[model samples]
Target: MASNVAQFAEGEDPQQMSSDTAALQDQGWALDTDGMGVTKTFHFKSYFKAVAFVNLIAAESSAKKHHPTMTMRIGSVDVHWTTHRPRGLTHKDIDLARHCDRGAGLMGAVESGQGIKCGPKN
Candidate 1:
């Protein structure tokens, strides 16, 4: 989907980032308000399933060597992707976000389509 961005390079320029962000948004990801990352949350019926989804993402990130920050709760997992080297979102982040969508689907997670939400503070 989204014009076969499978081979997209990392650290794409600003215009390219905008295009990639639009495509990713169509797939249920949203750019963080701070303009540094993209994030989406997936919901599960059980804590075990949520953790399983996180595990799946962990394995994929490890294999790709592009890790994401994952937050797991009782029945959800939020995935955030950004490239630190270039100091902003990039094609790598978009691709990984797409991969996470597919991976979560395979694991039977119901994608929220609501972007991100912070947890309770200490």
Candidate 2:
């Protein structure tokens, strides 16, 4: 469920940030302690699944001209979103964060305890 998402034209607006990030938090996202970005970790059953989730986000990022810094682990992908041009969290970041969640689900993401360790379960 991709949406037409865009970045704000200015820096972080504290008043707007509160409401903007609250819902995401409920969905397992973390607002950066530095207050510059948001992050979430998605667990998967394999490294391939983890990488696939990154590619899914990449496609969405390319479509929106907005991207997140993603670190793919053996069985988890860490996604961090922020707008450097406007120097803060934007609607783009929020929207993409949600997209990451969707993509994770589509990739068959598992819970942290169920994640693949080396490659596959024996």
Candidate 3:
């Protein structure tokens, strides 16, 4: 099931954030306390793998024209997505967040707290 099956219109009301956040939560994304963005951290076994995953995220961001704020660690990456133009979350951010999760899975990256059991490729 695609996490971003829903689309939001420009200037959508904040009321929709509840449902949008719920869908993202199921996919491992956490909403910021301010309710303005969603974040997720991906873990890898090596720095090289982490960098490779970041590259995939970059490509996706560029393709969608919706960039995210990223923090790279030795073997992990934190991705925070928010639509800045209108200053809140949007369908684009949700869709890109889902893509990030899918891309991370394909590259053998796992969520930060999931450890080895969550490694989809293993």
Candidate lDDT (C-alpha), each: 0.74, 0.80, 0.77
lDDT of 2 by residue, 73-120 (tens): 888888999888877678788889988888888999988889988744
Candidate 2 stretches with Cα past 4 Å from truth are 1-17, 119-122
How well does candidate 3 score on lDDT at residue 33?
56
| Each prediction's TM-score versus the true structure | 0.76, 0.83, 0.77
TM-score of 3: 0.77
- Provide the lowest-lDDT 10-residue window in model 3: 1-10
Clashing pairs in 3: none
The alpha-carbon root-mean-square deviation between model 3 and the true structure, to one decimal in Å, is 6.9
lDDT of 3 by residue, 2-111 (tens): 23323333687556756766877898787765667788888887778888889999998998889999998877888988887877778888889889888888888865
Across 1-122, the per-residue lDDT of candidate 1 in tens digits comes to 12222222354676777787878878877766556788888887667778778988888789889999888877788788877786777777887898888887877776564323346634
Ranking by TM-score: 2, 3, 1
Model 1's alpha-carbon lDDT is 0.74
